[model samples]
Target: MQTLSTDVAIIGAGTAGLAAYRAAREHTDKVLLIEGGPHGTTCARVGCMPSKLLIAAAEHAHHASHNGVFGVDYAAPKIDGKKVMQRVQKERDRFVGFVLKSVDSFPAQHKISGYATFVNQQQLQVEQADGTQLTINAHRIVIATGSSPFVPEFLKSAGDRLLINDDLFELTDLPQSVAVFGPGVIGLELGQALSRLGVKVVMFGASGSLGPLQDEKIRDYAHAQFNQEFYLDSAAKVEHISHQGNSVQVRYQHRDKGLISESFDYLLAATGRRANLTQLRIENADLTLDDLGVPVHDRYTGQCGQSPIFIAGDVSNAIPLLHEAADEGKIAGDNAGRSLKNAADVRAGLRRTPIGVVFTEPQIATVGLSLPQLKQRGEHCYAIGEVSFEDQGRSRVMHKNIGLLRVYGEQGTGLLLGAEMFGPAAEHIAHQLAWVIQMRMTVPQILDLPFYHPVIEEGVRTALRDLNHQLHIGPEMVEKCLDCGPGA
Candidate 1:
């Protein structure tokens, strides 16, 4: 057995872990970064980058097939499944290589290749691949082990025919058919992409949820828009899942067709993800735990019940986005490193305004506080402003007119609070809204910003104008206003 000591020890060399290491190094050189698996971020390896690459290919195919509305005629797009997967895999490995390069640049002495288990609040036991054990006594510890996909117990019956988002990228060619068991971000994105790429896809959700939209109206609008291209049931009653030869069979109650059985090349379990905390033997960590057995920690300071131990990233379960994980990791690492010099060095870190985007056709985005979050806080003094892309000039010009955008503002102050959108250029609009929300701008202030004529952003101006009216600060919206030009 070998024993070592460090000022700070961070688990999992992922996005959060790498960020933590960099942050901790700023405060102390006596920091150790530990990894049990390969070095690469979830975004680079399986989550964001690869998925977007696949989505890009899907968009190209979809646009080619749907451009007839503009009198632009093209033969049906030929989807080379093998070439699509080849590009996805090739680009995915390139992204992973960049991450590996970054990890390689770090000092060798600071990196440990082993799986770590908690011995106590301040101690860890790591088992290396070479059959050696090392005991590490860290002055402060940061847990950033990230998360793994969660498969429902019943889905396991599909045996080897089952797949997850991670497994999907490994395929040599796109499957002929897929039955997606969740309509969350991963399911919707992958399911729709597959459908666009000439694969048969059916997506099912346990609850009446579509993407990340909180507004029921927007969810319904998005549900309809997606169904126009592929089969989706936001709330499904599935009967059984079984392995049939090389394929997976799904039996479910269809909304209009009654009970139905469908066979697919794979049963994708996109249910959800759970924090990777169980294997650490947290029971022996001597820390307060939540109902789900995760450490009770303050998200602001990343401190676990005033202990020297900190939690960050997906393991923290605050927000699973990559940017949030990076922020939390920096906070945890900074606090952990500074605590070595003085325990009082712990302080709340910068928390950015919440912004999320789902890269689906039309797209789905949420900025700042969602409507459900406001209601959860027992706040009622707010007004909603809405715009439909179905008639927006730019959207209509592009023949991409489908979906809705809703902006929220404080009733009295007229301050922009948040927005939920399922519309064209939602990803771009969400970034603009996020900036204003972070700056604490009002509806009128946002309207004062220049909106180019006949652009998709004119739709945003329309929503804000409506919000201003609802706040009693601007004139009532005029339908097809001649003064605001065609789209406005």
Candidate 2:
């Protein structure tokens, strides 16, 4: 077996692993990056980029079909499914190529193209693709193996007819009809996109909630918007799934609706994701694992137990967004390089104000804290400010006014807390609110900032102004102004 030694060993070559590898390089050149799966970051390969491409195509087709209101009377848009998929793949490959090119700057020897197994806390036995073996010993280790889509046992018999995000993007042709078995982010986005592209899609969720969103107003608005586009049956309990030739049949019972059985060309198992930790051999590391088998590491430090090993990315399961993964990776890499005792001093805290965006017709975005989070922490004294997109002038002009925006702040101090919205350009508004919350700005302080007129942002200003009026500290206090130049 070939033996290798490094200052830090990073597992997986996805986003978090790459970030950790880069950060570890700042401290020492002795770093080994081992990847078991395909190259290119998850966002570029299958998660974000290709999915957005699909959504963009669907949006164009939808707009073209419904342009009668704009005085531009055009025939229904013709969708060449194969061509659309080809374009998505072509562009997706370009993005993956760019990510691969970035990795080319690092020395080839520093990266291992293989699956790594933990022989001990500080040692890994890597098995290369071509029956080669390498033993790597590292002073510190970062587990950024990322995650994989979870499929239930009931769908196992469907085999090739079952699709996940990994295979969905590579489809050469669109299915005539699809049944998506999760109304979460992936399920809702892909389900709506398929419906817009002229495919019959039925989305089923475990609960009435569309996704991870906890707010009632935003969820109701989003659910209503989506129900108008495609069939949605949340509160469904899947009984069984059977494959017959090219199609699959799904049997489920809805809480409101009675027993229902549906057949479709494809079955998409968008039932969330689980961390890739089976090969890590955590027993060797002597870490306390939770019920889900994930290590009980500190969310802030990413340190696993009292050992020199750290965990990051989707594997940590603290927050699974791409940006959060990168940040955690940097923190893990930085802390891994330090002495075990001193690592806690430099440990980074997870961002309290979480931000996540769901790219639908009127995008859904949640920023800062959620109502459930605040209640779980026993801090529920908050007020809300809201505005409907139907009232926004720009939205009305664009013929895309279909959702609502709500902002939350502390009741007494008027400190900005969180926000959830389903509206046009909600992603941008969410980011602005996230920044405001990160800066710990109050409602009046945010209102003090300038707001441009005649834009969708003006809608945000209206919400802030509404919230400012509710606060006790705004528009009611004035300080003395000295007039030195005036003759008094």
Candidate 3:
């Protein structure tokens, strides 16, 4: 057996895995990245990147279908699904190739096709694709294998038509009709996209809410606008098939409303995803797994207690979102490598705050403790303010005025704890809010910052004004402004 040793070993080369790999390499020379399967199956290569491309194409088609709204009239836009798929696949291929090339810079070794199983506490028996087994011993190991789409027990995985995010793109032809079993971000975005692509889409959710992080107002607006049929409060009992050449059947109940049946061209199990750690044999490394088989790690350090092992990305069971995975992986990689540099006193980075974004048109983004979450925690914070995109000149000029920005401030302290924004450029705005929360800036600090006109940033100025008004600081500031100038 070929034996190897490294300062840190990272399994999974996806977002978090790559981040960890890069960070570890920056700190030390001996870093190894081991990955299973073909590299294209990663989220960036397959899930998020490809899906977003298709979603963007669908969104463009949707906009073109409404040309009259923009003073241009047209018949419906024809969706050439094949053309869209071709472009998406091309993009996915280019991205994966680019990422692989970039990772070559780090002082790290890559094992493209290997199944790593723990042979002992500090050694992992690596089985290559061609049946060659090797052993790699590492002082610290990071599990960033990420996650796979979840298949609910109620939904049988027998048929080929049923798809997850990974398999959704493999279809030779577009599904005429689909039943998406979850109304979270994935299902909502894909359902809307498929609907625009001439696919009749229905979404099923246990609760009435669509996206857990989505504001009710925004979700309601989307559900009302889209042609998607939502089966809220409905639980699927068992989705099965009698035989081939037949539609997939779903048996569900509307809580107190009893039973019902529905059929569709395909069923998408967008319920959620769980970590792909089954192959790793976590027990062999003295690491613990949660009910879903995700690794248990300290939130601050990304370190698995009782084991010199850590995990980031989907394996950590944090938000499972892309950005969250990236940041956690950054910390995991840094900590793993830094541990060697300052083995006696190294402390990993802590995630005191998290930002979330759901990429829906009029997309929504949030950071820190939300109002309800704060309320639930008995946090008395009363600095509440909201700004309408309609009031912003930039949004008006861009014809993207359908949005709202809400800020929750600490009652006595002017520090911002939470911010939620929905509308055009919400993703960009969310990052700015994340900085605001991270710094815990006061309202005065925000108002003092100069922002240019005819830009979405002006929205932050408006939000600050509203916050000052809510705090009755605007009147006081205006009175002080006259005499508080440089001359005064």
Off by over 4 Å in 2: 253-258, 340-345, 349-352, 377-380, 469-488
Location of the lowest summed lDDT over 10 successive residues in candidate 2: 479-488
User: In model 3, which runs have C-alpha deviations exceeding 4 angstroms?
Assistant: 103-112, 212-246, 251-262, 288-293, 350-353, 390-399, 451-463, 475-488
Error of 2 at 433 (Å): 0.7
C-alpha lDDT (0 to 100) for residue 121 of candidate 1: 88
Candidate 3 per-residue lDDT, tens place, 1-488, comes to: 78888889888888898888878877887888888766543665757787788888887887655465668776788878788778888887887777767766544355446988876657888888889988898888888888878887656642765778777776656778888888777887787778778887767776666564544554565455443333433234443432135567666664456676667878888888777878888778766677776667787788887566878888787788777788888888888888875655446686756787777776778787776777775645466677777656677765676777777777667777787776779888888878877887878787787776558777766676677777666652232123323211
Q: Score candidate 2 by lDDT.
A: 0.83
TM-score of each: 0.98, 0.93, 0.85
By lDDT, the best candidate is: 1
Each prediction's RMSD to truth: 1.1, 5.3, 4.9
RMSD of 3: 4.9
Best by TM-score: 1
For candidate 1, the clash count comes to 0
